[model samples]
Target: AEAGRFFCTAGRGLEPFLAREGLTLGRVRRVFSPKVDCVSGKVFFRAAARPGELRKLRSGERLFLLLKKHSPLPVSRNRGKMLQEIKSLVIEEPKYWLDIISVWRKLHGHEGETDDVSQENALALKRKSEEETNTTSKRQKTEQVRAVVSEECQVEAGETCVAPERTSNQECWIESKTSSEFPPKGSGETPSANEKLGFSFRVSCRCSGAIAKILTSQEIGRAIGITLVKQCGWRADLRDPDLEIFVHLNDIQSVVGIPLFRLPLANREYIKTAGLRSTVAWAMASLAEISAGSLVLDPMCGLGTILLEAAKEWPEACYWGSDISDLQLEGADGNIRTAGLMDKIELLKSSVKALPLPSESFDTVISDIPFGKKFKTTNDAQLLPDALQEMERVLRVGGTLVLLLSQELRRCVDGLTKCAGGDAAEASADSDSGAAPAQASSVDGNSSSLAQGGGESVLSRRFGSLVPEGVYAVSLGKTDAFIHKYRKVSAPGQK
Candidate 1:
């Protein structure tokens, strides 16, 4: 095993949360790239780690072992120069010596070349090539060497590593059975060269740089693969391999690594019914700020994603998830059973617009409301207002309601204003902006009057009127989707 630095990536807006999760793995180092859509962090875990430990991560979409991080090139260069730069970095870093040595060991598996046999062949070829006109046989060796180095480029840049020929075909990623984390053995304790592990590798490249404008991603991948294979004697597996390297190159910098986790950490095995992405669900739970033993409710719980995430984070808290759809409730039931959380979570059939629960019954309320697109019910026009009113009615003063929705801002504002007892007509007339709201329409899967309407600030004012205590919307990049956080206050005119 070798000592390695690793990084984890997440969706946009989830970098902070992913970084927080990474801290639990080891010392949090640096954010790899801030400008990219992905959030990545450098983490140092000094001891040997097992796959089980990484599987526990909640917010990360993918994890990779950092091979190198370099400053962006001053000017776009030809493939030859780029290959030269990569070779230099690997050469200067002794830590990469093990990687290169390991590359030779991996070659033993492909053509039945043993460790001793393969090195002897490479060295013999090396000598003969220096004497000859780089024979056709020598060129074949050079291509393999180049492929290994190109794979290094992929690992350097934090993009997937797949064989150049196989890049067009789907790649089957392989996980390491032996741990990558281990203290360097003393020279006396180190195994001989013959005993080292074998690994197959592929190089993948993503380009957002000036050079990228000239080179297609495939061209870059092919060139790097050819050079790396020729130089390192690394084996290439187009289908299944022991390792996959990645490269992400932008105008600002290049990132590379070997991925650790087979899938994003967000995909929990207990999830039988998947609705929102686990990352989104985790974010919703985090925003709710649940307290110990707090009573929480998701009135429109589609598949109990929010409740499941909250229950995992705050096991002591009581959770209640209800939905008007029997099918969805049944799926939530299966998931709850799979998680062995039937005792911690209560599932029921009920509509958000009219809950069967008592008023001020919950300490926290979090939900993913129908965007009026996928979650169309009978009274689509009045659904948002009705749900908000019910949520407010059941939430205790000072309780939090974190709601995710994708609808027109004006329609949402109007709905909340109406729910807060403000006359929609009066509120519209009082507006000095004089921007007419869009007519009701269907977007995504939900129906609402949210469209290309004016009066952008309407959501803030409407939230103020409804919550009174506090309110804010966390944008999720999409114009329609947002996580709306609201703290309940005494109803209008109450002391």
Candidate 2:
């Protein structure tokens, strides 16, 4: 029941949503980033009265149990003294660290457990990180690497990654590894550059900016690893760590933590062809204001990730998803079949600009428009009004329309013109988690304000009669996006 301050690494622009999840913790606050990488936002909060409520968060990319935070860490050009101080910081509160670990074990005891298909696959994914893999496999080489490659690997309670021990019986192995031995903080985590953890553990130090000029990440990791072994009785296991301790140092502050999971909190492994981050997908659906027995539609469903996410979260609804690409439709079909939700979801092949369904048939429509480098077009700005008009046409009176688009595209709304044809096949990727978009119907007798004091904004002015309910900025890797929620006021001139 003791309160704990936890740190979560969130996608840029998501800190506000994460902190507002009604976490039983004390007030959740944002941490300043040095802006080295696209590292935009960070937040920390103390949880006690309802620490269990932390599990309610879907926007946090990865969770870290904050062991300690050294704000305004004394930095020095003298590497030796700086290393010494950080080393001491590692073992400062051994008992408290152990207690935190215990809490972590309890809180996530069912981690890697999914109610949907593929629990084993999810667990397998969580059991290792790039830092844990001994050699890169052919499959892994082709896969897109995550923003942060954690050198710290995690294992289940009983499972262990056995490998030849790299350390002697020495209590502290103070190896002075060069920066080359460790990846940069932007790339990922630090120490025993080659040490694999099985029953053992590893220390990861993410050092950036001015801190790197004086101390290498490995130096910081080693300082912590050596002290952890000498004072805290933790074993070293880089390849298979029972515990992966993370220490991040920058111009702003130094943070030390233990990862609560091996994967992002929003990560869902039930479907492999998913476009857009699962967290983002969940947000878009939340803004739909879905109610039981309501009909929901995703016109540019891509691999059906958004619909899949919505169906799983709001099962009582009849879900329909359509896309123009045969290849994409096939992929979505497979994903839907694999998730075993065929009964609740319906998939069709149709263009977003001209949906096959009749007008005013569905209760809600949510879409993640194609934009940016991943899915680009010559005149993407020119495509919005047409697709949006089609979406409005099919939406029943007073229905909710949630759109996810790039901030760049949103800004280009002023010079909009209707383009012939539907969105390109490239427009099939998107994700979101929201203000419960599809909660009790916002389309009832009166519309629900997306936020307490929400009013007409961006999409409302450029398009038809869709009134802007709420809009939230979201960070998708290098791309900046927004989730827009709207309710039809009078079906575009019905008034």
Cα error of candidate 1 at position 432, Å: 15
> What CA root-mean-square deviation does each model show from the true structure?
9.8, 15.2
Name the runs in model 2 displaced over 4 angstroms.
1-4, 22-40, 46-56, 104-199, 376-379, 414-462
lDDT of each: 0.58, 0.60
Cα lDDT tens digits, model 1, 226-336, are: 444444444555344445556666676667666665555667888987877777788778778788889999998988988888898789999999998999999899989
Per-prediction TM-score to the true structure, in the order listed: 0.69, 0.66
- How well is each residue in 1-495 modelled by candidate 2, as lDDT tens digits? 555667777776676656554342234422222221223456776555333355546666767777777764687877667777777666444345545555665665644543321232233233333324544542342221110011222211111111112333322222232111222233233444333221255676677878788866655665566455434434565544556777777777778777766665676767867788877887778778888999999998888888988888788999999988898889989989988988998988888878889988999999888873565443444455568789888888789988887655544331221111012211322322221131121112232232233322333333445555666778787878877676765665665
Query: Model 1 — which ten-residue stretch has the worst lDDT?
Result: 174-183
Off by over 4 Å in 1: 1-4, 23-53, 74-198, 375-381, 407-411, 414-440, 443-480, 491-495
Report the error of model 2 at residue 102, Å: 3.9
